[model samples]
Target chain A: MRSRSCIDERAARKAQPALRKVGRGASGRGHGNAVPLPGPASGRRDQRRGMPPMMRWETRDEICELVLADEPCNEIGTHMLEALERFVAEARKLPARALVIRSEVRSGFSAGADLRELYAGILTRPREEHVPALRSFLDRIHAVMDALDTLPMTTIGAVHGVCFGGGFELALTCDLLVADRTARFGFPELRLGLIPGFGGIPRLRREVGNAVVRDLLLTGRTINAKKAATLGFVSQVVAPGEATDVARRMAAQAARFDRDAAVTAKAFLKPLPREELAREKEHFVRLFQNPCVTEALRRFVESKDVRPYLP
Target chain B: MSDTVTRLMALAARRFKADAAKLRAEADFFETLGIDSVQALELLSELELEFDVEIPDYELQGVKTFTALAERIDKRR
Candidate 1:
């Protein structure tokens, strides 16, 4: 079985220093450089100055709300991953008692991994550099997921529209998932001949039953919010366009609890499935090495089918 | 046309704001509704909620018409 030790030390080492920098370093590429968004109570105009285009956050009344606004369904790519890393680091330093992650994009919360970008990387980079590069990317994203998973405060994902693949994994990191009637959850990685690379399988299995996990992963079918709620993963299913409001209320309630008691309970109930997550990453890297993944990604990116997002 | 087809067409028109009279059973829903894949998923969700049936996305693969979609829902019902 491939393990963390099997990963290239050189590539892993290269990612460590960058991860350490956390928020804006001397290079001014961190949260410090992000545009200051108006807090929920501020009623101030949004200031988009210098904000990373992928994400932005505001804190008020000891609550932090981060908005994912990347265009075209908020596909997670290098830009989004970097933005998330910055958010994760900044979240640790905040005085917030609860965090709410929501999306402002019209289409959905997020469509998933940016297959076009992945395909582009594959075509532009040499085959020898592929696995190492992929592993590094996975490592960085996993770190963000781990950090979010273990944050001292309560976290809620206000989901709507498409939450598939990497996006589904990201939502799974939340302490609670609040999906609107319009929200849909899916794992379509199998269609591309790859597993969910962003620590999805382990987190999903932890939240829902093994049967539900197998159904979504193996069939590669998307499920609507009502169906997801019935399966017991989604904590609440609000009316359409009301997920964020419901999430904000949940955050408020969570913030009212004793911090230490809440943190302890969270730690005990939702310990990170570290071993499984590591194995999942290794499995993803192994599967990604196959040529079929590349070809499948190519077909996805190049396809003109109006229903390409469907099975 | 079957009642299922008629109701399906009506639902699509209401969800997508299309002209119910203009919606033909055989017409491609993608073209008739002027929607892409994402909107198609939204339509799928509406269908599930309306019909109270779970339609795996794969079941709708290559299905692009109102009558065909109704048949899928009918089988589930």
Candidate 2:
């Protein structure tokens, strides 16, 4: 079998040029999306040799930027999960004052969970082990999300294109979301016969009302960045390819404030919905046990239709 | 064709760099323009921006031609 990193590298190379073009007309600086580089601050090729395939982070001007650039779209599979875990670990040790999570993939921020990988796992493993495996993955992801959510520094999600399911959930982990006009946000898990297992529900409820949450979850319909802004979930709606730039500025502003005071204000303003999050994981695990989920994922993974992403 | 369909066809043609005169209101856009999923999404974004309306992706399910898409946009308007 081929290694995961190799596949991601191939896709990264294939997508690099088009990804670069997304920033061309934005600011004339042409740095619309920051490509992931190896090492903390030094741009050295040697340090890149063993870097993770899914993402990479670097700190500059006291702001740590994590760029998600894997594949056709950054699907949250084992590779992404592990990469995120590594990010949290590195982030905690960094002296950075702010964090910005963005994507360099031209297709979007992310399409969501790696449905193909999930389906393959179901096929290879025993049925009895499925729930346990899912539970383990959820537990690990939730831990990472919780850490990011409660991090003292202000975190911003600079999102564009498709931010659905787990991807949207990942964005919600940030303190604020800055979306490009082309961005579309949704929770399409209902189409897969499951709920978003990555704490999307509770996190979203923290940002918006229940009616908005219900519409997204029940309809599985995507909303444009403009609609998302009106719904009060996205903090800023920017021109195409400018989300990262806007987020970086926001991070800069955040850095100017007293770090301890900012941290305290964030803690006071945004409390984690611990109970709802725990209940959500249980509901997700229970829903994942249905055989229909496997079939739904299989169809999604194997689909050749142009609108497969459309729920 | 209705005016909505005509305008929708023209918008799609311009965005995709196709000949506006050669495009038809009733043509299957995905087939006519040779677009994949990402381009289809770009078109969706362009339409939402063009029409100033939110036509949910589910509403466009099975909608292939500019005429059908125009109807959905019209309804939302």
Candidate 3:
């Protein structure tokens, strides 16, 4: 079988000159001078003149940074998702044997879907307009997850602080996860009267177990990193500031293996069958009939404590 | 090295920069090559498929280098 690593390496090498040209241009412009021009202009410049500002590659380590540097309130906006997709695609082309992906946020990894956008879409727009917009947003999120899943290289998710909803789902797609002891993880979509539309339920079920997945989806409660590690959701729990280092170490070790075999094995261990997915969808449709789900939603909306059953 | 091992090692070195040429028969997998836990798990997953052997998570942290990994594979063989 052809080695995926070789294919990636070749592609990266072929693209190196273009990448370097962009790097030179960005450096020449001076970071401070690169104001947030109009979105279209900045985006065009990013595509034509160099790499996107949010993504950076460390060739020797086979690591990439997907930073969520926009203000915390801007979480899960259209621009962020676009940047994530672009970075993930570019990272897949890098020659590295394995890849380590870490969030660049200090306080929280990500705040899940942008609530402002959601509220505005539902309240101000017609259902026809709102549903398609929501679906498009979900599709973009799925694209990011799919890219992470399909990358031939082994991928590590190094998380800290808070990783909620879509951010949590993104981490679930990784082959391995490393988190700080105090990091928080959860699927808060239920509080908004919605499901985790970005592949969270299926992926979480595959990683942890069906029972835990049920509780999380039904209750939308957050869990600490230690608890996540204990439940086998997190692969490793490190000291507060050590998640990235641990992830890098893990990536470096994984890089030693035959990349083709790695890719094949990951593909082999994918989630349950299509029939099973359909059955799960049916159950989800009936979720409103369940007293537990309804009560949980009520309590979540009423500002009552619902933490006990969330994990 | 066997052809299979040689090719695999070359791929690893090229991608990981682990200096396969410097690997000794008894070297520790992670210690010698700076393999962290996540990378070790990924390597374990790859090895399991390549050799059709189940190298459990508990055993993954113990193996440190390609040479040691080869010995383990040899034993499994």
Candidate 4:
């Protein structure tokens, strides 16, 4: 029989190499210099400057940055979509046993579509170009989310502040979501006179009940972490500053298991049926036809200067 | 000496290792060898199936080493 002391010593030995890999000082390359700024601070500055934050990779299987940062409006553009796709692809290839995803923004995980990009696409591009551009962007976004979902590993979303629109969809694709007490989650696309174009509607409905998904999406209302947990949207809700730690712990635990089973299990549990997906597509078409959506689009157009729209 | 544990571990090690030299003892979890969280979870899932145990999220957060995890599995068994 293995004595407890012997087990503890073996565990420590097994864990030591991984721990050493964890706290390695940030490499001073690329945007790693930006590490000094907290996620919120960087987000705010990027918002002011009107540019997307440079996505940065840390040593211990973590990715941070505001994807759309300061871009034209709050809309995700082709460039940003490509960057995200690349990140997801690269992350899938990393040697880590699990992956943790977090945001740099303080009040909003992502404010949905970049309005400036949308406005530009609408105003400058021909009417015929609109659908193709939108579809292309959606496809790329779907690829990223799909990669996150099907990667042969454990994925955890460490959510704090606000997770809305596309950000909410991103979190939903993760295997687990660990949210901070201050975390706010929602799908306000309907209020904007649009549906969640990037797979948010079906994923949200599958995560929470249809009722909660209906209430949140149709009303464009926000739910706090506690409420989200009650509705089964959030896996765990920690103190405001504790999300990263909790995510790390979860990642650490995931690191100890077998990879094939994890991938197979995830593939098996995906809840979106073809019928539901078809219905969601119809909902998107109807939502774009609504006057509420038109007015919401107008509001989105007008709100360009408002720092970050906290959910 | 369950075939399940040995097979699961072998698969995990093969997926995680970049070179032949990296594979270590059964006690060496992938994380210690520079395996990321996603890879770790992939490994965990195999163990979950072999042991028929649902690893709770909280316990998942606490696992740091293979020996610690193996013991946890042993207890459940």
Using TM-score, give the best candidate's number: 1
- Give the alpha carbon lDDT tens digit for every residue of A152-258 in model 3: 88888888765777678677878888987546677766654456656667778887778887766675545667668879978998876798889888887888888
Question: Which model scores highest in lDDT?
Answer: 1
Please state the CAPRI-style docking class of candidate 1. acceptable
| CAPRI level of candidate 3 | incorrect
TM-score of 3: 0.58
Decoy 4 TM-score against native: 0.60
lDDT of 2 by residue, A85-117 (tens): 777876777778899999998878887776655
Colliding pairs, model 1: A24-A30
lDDT, candidate 4, A1-311, per-residue tens:
11111011111211111101111111100100000000111122223232234344443433222233321112243434555666665665566667777765443354454443454345455655555555555555666766776677777888875566776777788888898765666675654666676677678777767887777766665656766777886899787668878988888788777777766777788744446555654566445545564355445445422112211
Q: How many clashing pairs does model 1 include? A: 1
lDDT of 4 at A264: 72
Worst 10 residues of 3 chain A by lDDT: A28-37
- Work out the TM-score per prediction: 0.86, 0.86, 0.58, 0.60
**Best DockQ among the predictions, by candidate number:** 1
Select the stronger candidate by TM-score from 2 and 3: 2
**Candidate 4: where is the Cα deviation over 4 Å?**
A1-53, A59-75, A271-275, A278-295, A303-311, B1-77
In candidate 4 the C-alpha lDDT for residue B7 amounts to 53
| lDDT at residue B38 of model 1 (Cα atoms) | 71
**How large a fraction of the reference contact set does each model reproduce?**
0.56, 0.42, 0.00, 0.00
